[model samples]
Target: MDVIYVIDILGTFAFAISGALVASKKEFDLFGVIILAFVTAVGGGMLRDILINSHPINWIGDLNYIYTILTAVVCTFLFKSKIAPLRKTFFLFDTIGISVFTLLGLQKGLSLNLPAIVAIIMGMVSAVFGGVIRDVLSREVPLIFKKEIYASACLTGGLIYLLMKQIGVNENVNFIISAIVIITIRTVSVIYKLQLPKIKDDIFTRNQ
Candidate 1:
């Protein structure tokens, strides 16, 4: 199997587990957990593919995606107590998921002959939109909307990947370096409680 394909599958599983974790926190039943898992695993990818006009979609053409999601959901449900306490582990998987998806989306966009700016946006969308959907479903504010450096990490990584590519870096090496950059940024931001400054609500209501 291609390395990118493998990374994509692993990323899917990671996202699925992340979604299941959130569902468990919300005390969702089995069906709801599975639904959330599936959506979180493929929601962003599906949207990205749709935007790019990829035929048959991604997960729809690959049954492995479904199986991967089911496995993640089952494991999460069975080990909810043990897994819930492992916040770091969950964060690690989530970071990996976003990192891999970002690269995949960027590559896909480039392959479609999209401009670098559009590709970068696609990468960011692929990395975070699933979590956005998941949060909306869970009735919580989306992480991207929060002060945390979530989508920005993906955007940073995507830019680095493009730069490395332009400089003739090996594809695999570029992917590894870019993914590490994203993961490190996210980890450090969480540890340091780093966040983007929020706009004051008064600014929006000033004219009103």
Candidate 2:
């Protein structure tokens, strides 16, 4: 398989496993797990494809995406106990997934010869809508709105990817650089507890 396809499949698996783990935490039944896993693996890609008129959606054309999710579910079930250290593993995978999807989305938009702003939006949609669906289904606040620097990180990375591509950088190297930029930003922010400013409670109260 091509490297791009391999990366895409890996990203799909990681996202699906993350979704299933979340469902398990919520005490969801097997059916719920399957639904969440499927949506989380493909929802963002589907939304991106739709927005770009890219067609029939990816998983619909290839069973690989579905099988990837199924494999993730099975692996998660078997290795749940051994996967504790995988909290960080999953986070890294999620970051990689975000990067890959962002690149994929931007590539699609650029293929359509879209404007840069529209291409970035496509990238964000491809990277984020899956998590949005997961949150809605799990009855938790979505990460994008939780001030965790989630989709914004992807947007920033995607923009950088475009700029690098514009400078005639090779596509493969560009992807790695973009992914590292995103992962580094997210890791440092979380590690240092860096976040956007919050309205002080005193200020809000005085205003009211």
Candidate 3:
């Protein structure tokens, strides 16, 4: 089995777990939990594939993705009480998902001979849009739209990955390095309470 494929499955499971936990917290029904899990696991990848005109989208082409998501949902359902107390667990899984998804999308773009800039954008989309959809459904402000350094971390990691590839870095080495870069940035930002600068809250009120 390809290492990248393994990593992608792990990422999908992580994202599904996060979504399931959130839905559980929201007191969503079983159906809602499954729906959120499915969307959060594959929404970004599906969107990326559609935008690039890739055939049969990722989850559709691979039944393992569905099984992975269902397993994640079941685990979350059984372990919600234990999992919910670990405040950082959700963040950790989300970070992992973004790290893996970004590289996968970027690799796909390159495989299709897309421009590097376009590929980087694709990476960001794959890393971000799933969480965007998850948050929208849960009625929370999306992380990328808030002060968090969410999408920016993915974008930066994608750029560095492209640069490393150009410099003839080993494929596996480049992927590991890029994934770690994203995870480190996101984890550090959260640990240190770092945030992107925002306009003063009064700006909108003043205009009104």
Candidate 4:
């Protein structure tokens, strides 16, 4: 199997687990948990493929994706107590998911001859939209909109990937480097409590 394919599957599993963790935190029942997991695993990819007119969609054409999601949900369910305490584990998986999805989406857009800017946007969408959906479903503020360094990391990684490609880097090396850059950025941001500046309350009040 291709390395990208493997990365895609791993990303699916990671996102599924992340979603399941959220569902469990919200005390959702089994069915709701599985549904959230499935959505979080494929929602972004589905949107991306639809936007690009990729035929059949990804999960629709691949049973393995479904199996991977189900497996992640099951594992999360069975080990909720143990896993819930391990916040770092969930963060790690979520970081991996975003990194892989960003690269995969960027490559897909490029393959379809999209403009560089559009491809970068696609990469950001693929990396962050699933979590947005998950957070919306969970009735929480989405991290991407809340001054977090989530989508920015993906954008940075995508740009690095493009720059590397332009400079004649090997495809696999570029992929690895991009993913590493994203993962490292996210990890450091989280660990160090780094965040973007938020709009001050006075800015909104002044208009009113």
Highest-scoring model, TM-score: 4
Per-residue lDDT of candidate 4, residues 1-208 (tens digit): 2866776788788889888988988999999898889889998888889898987887898889999999998888788687768777667777887998998899989999999999998998888888888888999998679868889899999999999999999998888999999999998998898998776777769689
TM-score of each: 0.89, 0.89, 0.89, 0.90
Winner on TM-score between 1 and 4 is 4
Q: Candidate 4 at residue 155, lDDT? A: 96
lDDT value, candidate 4, whole model: 0.88
Best by lDDT: 3
Candidate 2 structure quality by residue, lDDT tens digits, 1-208: 2876787888898899988888889999888998899889899988888877887787888998989999988887888777657788888778777888888888888888999989989988888899898999898898778678777788899889989988999988998899888888878888887777666687768788
Residue pairs with clashing backbones, model 1: none
C-alpha lDDT values of all predictions = 0.88, 0.85, 0.89, 0.88
- Cα error, residue 72 of model 4, in Å, equals 1.3
Model 1 lowest lDDT segment of ten: 1-10
**Model 1, runs deviating above 4 Å:** 1-4, 201-208
Error of 4 at 185 (Å): 0.9
Candidate 3 residue 25 C-alpha distance from true site, Å:
2.4
The better candidate by lDDT, 2 or 3, is 3
Candidate 2 overall lDDT versus native: 0.85
Relative to the true structure, candidate 2 reaches a TM of 0.89
> Residue 53 CA error for candidate 4 (Å)?
1.4
lDDT of 3 by residue, 1-208 (tens): 2876777787888889888987888999999999999888898998999999998998889889999999989888888788778757667767887898999899999999999999999999998888889999999998679878888889999999999999999988999999999999988987798888877777779789
Lowest lDDT 10-mer window, candidate 2?
Answer: 195-204
State how far residue 20 of model 4 sits from its true place (Å).
1.3
